[model samples]
Target: MDFKVREVVPHGRNYALLRMMPVKGEMPEVEPGQFVQVEIPNSKSTYLRRPISINWADRREMWLLVRRAGAGTNALCDLPEGSRLSIILPLGRGFDLSVRGNVLLVGGGVGTAPLLMLGKRLVTLGVDVKFLLGARTTSDLLQLELFKQTGETRVTTEDGSMGHRGLVTDHPLLTDGEIDHIACCGPLPMMKAVAAIARSRGISCEVSLENMMACGIGACLCCVEDTVDAGNVCVCKEGPVFNIKRLKW
Candidate 1:
């Protein structure tokens, strides 16, 4: 679907919240943890579209929390309202919403983008949802109140500028042994540590991978991830989200 930029709100210095609406048809069904490949307009250097997580989506609009990591992403962040951008959306499998349990959604840095929608969906399903967000400083903890509206929200900052003064794993909630399931998205190391903690507690866990992607479909084979069952599959197709057990990590 091609979506027109509706708004771009900046967060601190490096991040921007993008709001977009479909150019023609009604919005397609988008699942939390699924992503979109966005076409960067007027960029000579960026040939491939960037895969951005679907932060929040509805029938009328789509939200993307973009980090200005490169020239391609910077161009996207600078887009004006009404600029049309092509997007291949709601791609890849999302977190399982069926299980009834005390669930924790963990995110590090901009990885927190996907969890808001996941939390909102879980809330609607009458499932218990809690969020654990981590950042380097309090300034990096964007949209804390929004997550709190869905469930109990906690924060961890490396500099002791937020709720807790360490990693999300260092938070008391992770050691409580009450969490039945966990859905996490973040840097590889953070996700790995969270998955390990979940494994130690025998809790079911899923992690969304921030893999390098090109086609946003199975064809490119650019985002291949090795798994225990499947030899190597494209993250754009087989995942972006996977069970902790399925991963070789």
Candidate 2:
């Protein structure tokens, strides 16, 4: 389907939130944690594509919260409004929404985008969701009020510029036993910490791996991750979201 860039907004210091209008056709039915491969022709060498998480998706339109991490993202950020970009939406498996009990959502840095959308879904389904958003500094934080609208919220920053002076695990949600299910997407170490805490507490938890990719589909072998049960799992095909019990980490 052809998606048109409708609007663009800056998120954090290095990221931008792109709002795109979906074209009429088979709309990509994406879960909260899935992503899309965007084909931008802003540069010559960075051709073919770059993979970006579906950050925040909805029915008619969805927002992509992307940080300008490198060449691909830089090209995307330079796109002007009304530009037509080739994108494959909902290209991968997403978070498991069926287990909608009390959910504690955690995200760090640019990874918090998808969790914001997930929190919204959880609230709509009557599942309680508490958020722990972390960043290195105040400038790294994104979508504060947006997630707050979903449910109760907490925040942490490594430099103590905003919330607690520590990692995301320092947030009350991790130490508090009230959380029923935990869902996380963040830096590897941060996600590991949250996942470990959830495991220790015997709470069901899920983590989305933010792997670098060329194709958002399973065609490329770039996103393969090692697993305990399944030796190799494709983040784009098998899942970007994995249950704590299943992952080797």
Candidate 3:
């Protein structure tokens, strides 16, 4: 389906928060960690559509927090408000929303996009939601005030320009022993470190993988991830979201 760009809000030089609406009907229901395969317009060098996480969604609007990683994303960020974009949405699996009790959401860089909707959904379900957001510097953090509105929010920046002076794993909350479940998305190393902490504490945890995907569906064999039970599976189809137990990590 084609969506019309409603607005583009730039966050410094590397990221843009795009507000879009369906060109025809109301927006479709999108799960927290699901993504959209967006076709970049007027890009000669780009072929495959970029898979972007569903940052947030409502009845009439959808948000995509995009990082300028390459030509495709840079073209997307450069789009005007009225530009039309073709998108295949609600693709891939999302975080399990059945969770309850004390839940902590950890994210880094652009990987933090999906957690906002997850936190909001969990909040509506009466789940106690908390966020541990990490970035390289204070300026790298996105949507702090919005996250605070959804839950108790914390931060960790490598430069110590934000909440805590180290990685998210170094934050004191991880050792507090009060969290029941953890949902994380970030760089592979960060997710692995967070998963290790969760494993040591015996806390249920899930991680969203940022695998390279040429096709958003499983056909391309571009985003395969080796799992404990499934062996190698396509991350774009089987999951962008998976429980720690299922992963070979």
- Which lDDT value does model 1 have at 130? 90
Write model 2 residue lDDT over 112-188, tens digit each, in one string. 98898788877888887888889999899998888888788888989998888999887666877587788899989
The models' CA-based lDDT, in order, is: 0.91, 0.82, 0.93
Residue range 1-249, candidate 1, lDDT tens digits: 788898999988889999999999889998888998898998998999899999999999999999989999999888887899988877898888886789999999999999999999999999999999999998888788899998999999999988999999899898674898999999899999999999999999999997898898899888899999988989989889999899999
lDDT of 3: 0.93
**All candidates in order of lDDT, best leading:** 3, 1, 2
Query: In model 1, what lDDT does residue 57 have?
Result: 92
Clashing pairs in 3: none
lDDT of 3 by residue, 91-146 (tens): 99999999989999999988899999999999999999999999999888999999
Question: Pick by lDDT: which candidate is best?
Answer: 3
Off by over 4 Å in 2: none
Candidate 3 regions exceeding 4 Å error are: none
